[model samples]
Target: MLTTSTRLKLQNICSRLAQGEFVSLQERVYLQKFAERDRSVSTWVSRAQRFQREGTQQGLDGLMADLDLGRRNPDDPEHPEDDLGDWFSNASPWLRRD
Candidate 1:
C-alpha cells in the first residue's frame, strides 16, 4: 500500500542495496519517514520464519488434519456442555468405546 513516491523511493533503496551500497543521507532520510513500516515488515518476517520452521517440523498433513478436526458436530455425543471441565467427561458414551 505504498504511495507512488514511496514505492519509487523503496525501489531506489533496493537497487542501491543490491549494488552493495548502505544508506546514503537521502536514502536514510526517506527510510526515517517510513521507519515504523519497516519495523513491522521485519517483525512479520521473523514471525513467518518461526511459523515456517515449526510447521515443517510438524509436517503439512499433520497441520491440515489438526485444522480439519477443529470443527465439532452439534449432534455428536462427544460434544461437551455446561462446565468445560466436565464437558466431554461422558464422551465415551457418545463415541465408540473401542
Candidate 2:
C-alpha cells in the first residue's frame, strides 16, 4: 500500500512514463506494482474514458492505434487475441513506456 502522497506521485510518474518521458529510480520502485495487479473491465473502461478525454480528436481509432503502438514491439510477450480486452485485462496501461 502507498500513502496518498505516494499514490499521487506514482500516478504522475506513470503519466510521464506513458508519454515516453523520463522517470527516476524512485518512481520505478513505486510503479512496479502496476505490473502485479489484475486488469479488470473497469480498468479498461477507465483508460478508455481517459483516452476519450485526452485524445478525442483521434477518437476510438486513435485509441486502437495507441494500443497497437503499445504492443508493436515484436519482443512484447502478450498480444491481443479478439479485441484488446485480453491485453487490457492482463496488463496495466501505466506500465507502458511507449
Candidate 3:
C-alpha cells in the first residue's frame, strides 16, 4: 500500500534503526505522514521518538530483539518470500519493516 518513495523511506528508516543509528528527517516525515494509517509503522515511530528523547538505544535494541523473534503478517499476500518482513526475517534483524 506504500508508494515507491515511501517504501524507500521505510527501508531507509529500518536500516538506520537496525544499525542503531538515529532516524533522519526524511524518515521522521515518513513516520508522521503514515502514522495515522499504519499501526505497525506508527508503533515503530513512536518507539523511535521516545528512545530518542530519553537519550538511549533501548528502542533500537528492542527492535533488534523483535526482529530476532521473527513475525507473521496476515495482511500481505506475497509473504514468506519477497515481502519486506520476510526479507528481513530471512536476512538481517537489523533490517526492519512494518
Candidate 4:
C-alpha cells in the first residue's frame, strides 16, 4: 500500500498531466517507480499519457471513471462495465482489432 503522502503526490502529478502540463524528469521517474509496484498507479500513468497524446479530456475522464477514480457519482447505480462499449470504441486506434 502506498503512503497517504505518496498517493497525494501522485494525484497531483496526474492532475498536472491531465491539464497538459509538463512534469520534470524527476517526477516522471518517481511516477515510474510507483507505477512499477502498483497496478492502479500504472493505469493512471497510462491514462495520463493517453490524454497527453490524444488531447481529449473526455476520453481520459471516461477511462479514469472506469478505474473508479474521480467518479462523479457513487449512488448512480451504473456499473463501470456499462460503459465498456463506449470505452472500447473510443480506445486508441492501435488498441483496436479492426
Considering every candidate listed, which one attains the maximal lDDT? Answer: 4
Worst 10 residues of 1 by lDDT: 41-50
RMSD of each: 13.9, 12.8, 14.6, 12.2
Ranking by TM-score: 4, 2, 3, 1
Work out candidate 2's RMSD over C-alphas: 12.8
lDDT of 4 by residue, 31-65 (tens): 99999999989888867766655465467676765
In model 3, the runs with Cα more than 4 Å from the true position are 43-98
Whichever of 2 and 3 has more TM-score, that candidate is 2
Q: List, residue by residue over 42-63, the lDDT tens digit for candidate 3.
A: 6665454444433343576567
Candidates 2 and 4 compared: the better one by lDDT is: 4
Clashes of each: 0, 0, 0, 0
Model 4: what TM-score? 0.56
Worst 10 residues of 4 by lDDT: 72-81
Worst 10 residues of 2 by lDDT: 38-47
What would you estimate as the lDDT of candidate 2? 0.53
User: What TM-score against the true fold does each predicted structure earn?
Assistant: 0.31, 0.41, 0.36, 0.56
For model 1, the stretches where C-alpha displacement exceeds 4 angstroms are 38-98
Q: Please report the TM-score between candidate 1 and the true structure.
A: 0.31
Q: Which ranges of candidate 2 are over 4 A from the true structure?
A: 34-57, 63-75, 78-98
